[model samples]
Target: MAGEQKRFARFFFYLRNLREAALHTGARAEEAEDRGLELLHSAETEAELKKLEEADSDTLSYVKRGLNRIAFGAVNDAVKLVFDADNMTARDIMGMDLFNVSEIKISGKNVLEIKFFDRQKALEKLGELAPQLDGGGESKRLIESIYGRDGDSL
Candidate 1:
């Protein structure tokens, strides 16, 4: 009775904490809470909780990698190969990395069109994940160096 209540209280506490963390990591509120609940329900012991944490870390890393891939045009090689080939084949199309591609269209005249997921959006998300990559401090230093630290040189 009391023990079960205590366990549930602890569980809710950790679920709220995890939701806050997920929100900080850019998840929507509902999504954060839902995922937190799901993760908490999946874990029974401290060791299981640690394993869940590791799995979450791995998922975040995978998302960051995917964002980098989209932001940096990592799919360009495949796209270029497909474009440069004299004749398009199923194999060539199958080998292309189209994860970043949002849409494809072909007109009656055989003009192929490829639209990609927004690179700028991907970069912004990556920046949110890694704020140090923004280079704000470096930019400030460069500005101060040019303006004698007071902007009075102008």
Candidate 2:
């Protein structure tokens, strides 16, 4: 009778853990969907939408692996909250200091106009490279190298 009771207890424990994992997965999915929709609505161009889709795909794959690890019970309690919103959320991506950001306006499709607080200073600093901003081959290569084909790091 004692052995049977022990088995039942162990079964319940596993059940509870799996339930928690499911809840976590659902919450993350909801948050991701909300943020994704917001990004889509704010997107001005098809290119921007495509970029968001690519990011979503990468994030989905990462989350799937993490969830699989959880299912196998290989994850520690501390790691369970790795995706906690407070620790690291989609909002964190745009958590820039308001003071440093003077303005963010959509100038046109596939274009975002961001004005920094120290606009004059910024222009002054970039004055030397202003000529290169005029579609210089060096500038183009530099940007392409930093942001590869899919805008993923090279």
Candidate 3:
């Protein structure tokens, strides 16, 4: 009906207007951000500007570390998926030629050590193959010791 058509027209008109307004708002926000950066760069003293720059760099580094942690977590999950229990054996992963596995003494017991080769592929394989004798926490800690990082700053 004509009423429905008018309603739809009004809806689209409002949507378009909102979109335009959002675009303008975004532009203004960007301009304001640029001006802020300009003002920061135009600090009263060189030492003050250098301090601000250092703070910005520190923030960027923290962001990078957080991103890296997220990325590493994703990769670790993917590795767990790819290296399931059935894919590898708990004992003798690097049988004779891989040279990526070794025996290490841990708490008076001999345990297999995995070298972090290419995004921890070897470690992932070892984790999959590690015996679940201790409800899996032992194996998880083993892997974490090699790759775990503290991100207190983030």
Model 2 stretches with alpha carbons more than 4 Å out: 1-117, 136-154
> How would you encode candidate 2's per-residue C-alpha lDDT over 39-149 as one tens digit per residue?
323423234435434553544334333333333432222232333424555565333223234465655664545543453454454454444433355666667788975
Q: Write the per-residue lDDT of candidate 3 for residues 22-96, one digit (tens) a residue.
A: 222232433633433333233232344354445535343343333333323223222342355246654533322
Cα lDDT tens digits for candidate 1, 63-127: 76567657754455347744765576778677555767888787688667777899999988987
Which clashing pairs does model 3 show?
none
Top-scoring candidate (TM-score): 1
Residue 150, model 3: Cα distance from true site in angstroms? 19
lDDT of each: 0.57, 0.39, 0.35
After superposition, candidate 1 runs with Cα above 4 Å error: 1-57, 75-86, 131-154
In candidate 2, how many clashes are counted? 0
Q: Where is the poorest 10-residue window by lDDT in model 3?
A: 12-21
Please give the ranking of all candidate structures by TM-score, highest first, separated by commas: 1, 2, 3
Residue 65 in model 2: lDDT: 33
**TM-score for each candidate, following the candidate numbering:** 0.42, 0.20, 0.16
Backbone clashes under 3 angstroms, per model:
0, 0, 0
What would the TM-score be for candidate 2 when compared with the true structure?
0.20
TM-score of candidate 3 against the unseen true structure: 0.16
